[model samples]
Target chain A: MILKTNNLCKQYQHKDGLVDALNHVSFEVNEGDFVTITGASGSGKTTLLLSLAGLIHATSGEIRIKDFDVVNASDRKLSDFRRKHIGFVMQSFALIPYLTAIENVMLPLAISKFKKEQKYQKALALLKLVDLENRKNHLPSELSAGQQQRVAIARALVNSPTLILADEPTGNLDPSLSTDILNLLKKINKEEKITILMVTHSPLAAEFGNRKINLHNGCIN
Target chain B: MNIRKLVWLEFKQHKSQLISGLLAITLGIAVIVGIRSISVVSEKAVAVNLDNLGANILVLPQASNVDNYYAADIDAPTMPEEYVDRIVSSNLEGVDNLSPKLTRRVKVGTENVVLTGILPKNEITSKPMWQQSGLLGNDLKASCAPSNAVNQSNGYEDEKLQRKVIDSLGADECLLGSTISRKLKLVDGSSVIILGETFKVSRVLNETGTVDDDRIFIHLHKAQELLKIPNQVSAIEIMGCCNAISDGLLSKLRNVLPDTRITTIGQIVATQIQTNKMMNKVSLIFLIIIIFVGGISIGNFMWANINERRKEIGMLRMIGFNKATIYQMILAKAFVLGIIGGIIGYILGTAAGVWLGPELAGLPVQPIPSLILISLCISIGVSLLGSILPAYLAGRIDPFKNMQEV
Candidate 1:
């Protein structure tokens, strides 16, 4: 298994008392599995993704990603784990506004021991893979919605991570651009054999996944 | 792709905010350096003035009530001129320079002008201190040199004569004070009748802004012969050595001359010293105020910057930048701002000091190179200190919380 979570739970203190954002969630995904997580608003899809990526601490859980326990890891160790093993894609295409397309793609390797020329070549190759090689010098604000998302994907793939965790990756795009992004993700999945756990509200996007998981009210249905 | 490059790009993005922070530090350092420079130069000028104006101590006849040294010899009771020999023979350590004078009111063209008799340096029969101290040598020479056409013909050839030390004066020749020379229309090499005796004017003294400006100077023996006070002097002016004066030279002189009235010009030096001390204190107070105000301004700017870049910070964290990295990035930006601000502030402050020193402190100042390092340290220190809390807060920002907002 590439990813595993057993009896995962997340609780939040609200003005109205304890609220369970995630409750005893359990799931598994093999290497190269294109797993799409479908959920309603506040259905714990993003929360589960965040917990798996070690962005958030689960109140209770056994989350083992490739034999490394996410829940038991220190913040620094989790950061290392995320840098080496996980790639995250967000709905807003979180490309730093001031940096160019290639520069944004190179952000993941900033703290790495890799040589500057090596990092640049890697980021350049990723941009080419996303067919944005000609627009490498353009900033995020200069790119269209689809082009920005492509740059985001290139950034996500630059580190050659074991898994990609995408939260509503196409929620901000129109249908045509959504299809293009979905197709690009599907192509990366089949060709590169990189596992992807994507959270989305669209059933059409969910259909692109090889394995599907649906969530409602913080529980699997 | 490195942290430094990332910081540069971010600085470009937030140019306005970063510039504002930079300006705050620059202004604070400028004010500190400018005030300090002026104060330093002013204090030096005062010390030079105190050293240049001679005869801090005066010895007058016991019956005289005169407090002013210049007027101490005018119509004063006479003391034995042998007292100069007594003090010289005593081999006192602090007696740096001495000028004994005898005065009388004499008619010159129907106006009664004060005629003061000063002992010639060659007549002092002891080792002179002027050679060692060069006391009143260069400055006095510069003052006596004719500054305008009206006094251009009043030049003297002897070094001591130009220095106003009067190593030797002819019995028939007299030095005219600036005011007296102008009033009587006298010049060097001109002859004037004083007390029914024809005397040649040797040189016209410079305007000293003192009672001496209105008096005429002649050899002591000549005045004694003319006035018939053959063995007496009105007052003895003493230039006490600086270190000796501080070590109770006045008391020592008083002990030696028990029958004479001795006084010191300590009040003038005391007032200048007090003013210097006050200026130093004011600069210190201003330094504190600038640090407080500048620190707050930079802190506010950083806080606002961190708030605005919350999403970007979270994204960096999500992509694997740890809290430490985030913290370093913020501090690195502040460090760059401080360094640039410091250099620019030093240049600007030095310029301001040069321009304002004369207007504010009545002294012309030069840029002190040592203050550059001090300005840099203060600027960098203030910038870093102000950003510490904000950097910590930025590091603590939860990636998930901020990303969720996006």
Candidate 2:
């Protein structure tokens, strides 16, 4: 398995009471599985994906990635794991505004143990893959929403992670642009055999995945 | 990520913020540097003055019931010759030179002048580096009287000039101070009439930037004879170890010669100390205000930088930068800024300070080490001090909250 969560749980507390975002949610993403997790708003798909990505702590139960027990790992180890093995594609496309497209793509590589020249070469290649090589010098603000998303995708793939977790990756795009992004994700999955776990509310978005799991009231079905 | 690259990225991302931190560091360093330079200048002034003054104790005759110290310039009173013998016999530590000086008030072309007596050999002990400006002391040495106190003195000792009778033992010539020479336009061979006697201006001492710079100097024997005093010397100006003359020695001197008086150089230098203290107070207040203003500018700039970098910090943390890395990044930016500012401020401050020294002293200003040291210290200090707040705020960034904002 590339990522596995056993009996995972997450809670959201309010002044009146507690809300279960994820309740005893158990799931797995095997290597090369392009899994799409679909749910309505507040159905806990985002929460579950966050927990699996190690962005947040699970209230209870275990999350393991590639034979490493992430739940038992230290903060340092988790950070290193995130930097090396996990890439996140946020709904808003978290491209640093100040950095050029290529530089933004090179960030993770910059943080890694890769040599400077190697990182540049890898980032350049990834930018080319996203068709943003010509627009590599453009700032995030200078790029269109679709181009920004492409830069973000290049950034996610620059470190060559085994698992990619994206939340609403194409939710902000038009149907045509959404299709392009979905096709790009599919191409990456087919060529690199990387596991992709995506959470989305759109059934149309879910259709691009190889398998779909529905989340309702914090339970997987 | 390697710390070096991370730090560089952080600096690059937050150039303005880093500049803010740098400004703070640079300013703090500049203040320290500027203060240090002034203190150094004062110290140099002290050295120059001490050199020209030569004798530590300056014995101006006691005025009759005069309370104002600054206005108490009186006629030269004859000191008992016996006290000189006692001071010489008392072998004290650090007692390198003792020479008597007599001040006579004279009018030269409508300008009030003061003529002082000098022993040419005393320059070596007092103004040890006096000959740096190529002023000859040949005639002064030549006209000196051998007081049965030492062996053959060096330099041209002419018998003709020594035989010019004032009260029977006066030297033929006088030396003009640099300022006095400039004021009277007297050259090396110019003749001047003073005290109804014509004396040749044998030499002019270089501008030493002391009271000596303003006076006329003559051989001791010439001063006594021209002033019509015989066998009577002015106050015994002692320049050697002050500690050697104690209460016991003073009492012994009184016992040996009851009519003679004894005073330390400390009493003579009290006015100078007061002036130094006053000037220090004024400079300190002004410099402190300037530094505080600069520090506030830095602090305000750093605070703004911290606020501006909040999102960047959040993003970095989200990307897996730990607390230590964030702190280190901020501090590194601060340090780089400080170093740059320090270098710039130091260069600017030193140039200005040296340029202004001559104007302030009314003479040529030389490069002083303490000034340079002060500037360097200020630059470094400002750099470090400026970083504290920005680094703290950067450290306080909560990645989740910050990243979620935009």
Residue B132 C-alpha lDDT in model 1: 41
Expressed as tens digits, the lDDT of each residue in A55-95 for candidate 1 is: 88999978999999999998888888888888888899888
| DockQ class, candidate 1 | acceptable
Which 10 consecutive residues of model 1 chain B have the lowest summed lDDT?
B144-153
What does candidate 2's lDDT look like per residue over B192-306, in tens digits? 8877778887876666555556677677667777777755666555443222232133444445445544444455345445645666776577556545665566667767866
**Stretches of candidate 2 exceeding 4 Å from the true structure:** B1-39, B57-263, B267-300, B351-377, B401-406
Instruction: Write model 2 residue lDDT over A1-221, tens digit each, in one string.
Output: 77788898888888989888889888777899999999878888877776775667778888989988877776667767877887777667877776788888887765567887888889899988989889988999999899998888888887789888888888778989999998999899999888898888888889989989898999887
Q: Against the true two-chain complex, what DockQ does each candidate achieve?
A: 0.39, 0.18
Compared with the true structure, what per-residue lDDT tens digits does model 1 show for residues B1-406? 9999999999989888777888777987888889888877765555444434656677998999776666877899999988876676566675656778898888889778999988766655333544444433332322211122212222444322343467678899899888999999999999998877889998888777778878888888899889999999998887665445655777888888899998877765475557667777987887787678878888899999999888888888888889899989989988887788888888988999999988998766889999999888888888888889999999888777534732
Candidate 2 lDDT score relative to the true structure = 0.64
Clashing pairs in model 1?
A: none
Considering every candidate listed, which one attains the maximal DockQ?
1
**What is the overall TM-score of model 2 with all chains considered together?**
0.65
TM-score of 1: 0.71
Scored by lDDT, model 1 comes in at 0.82
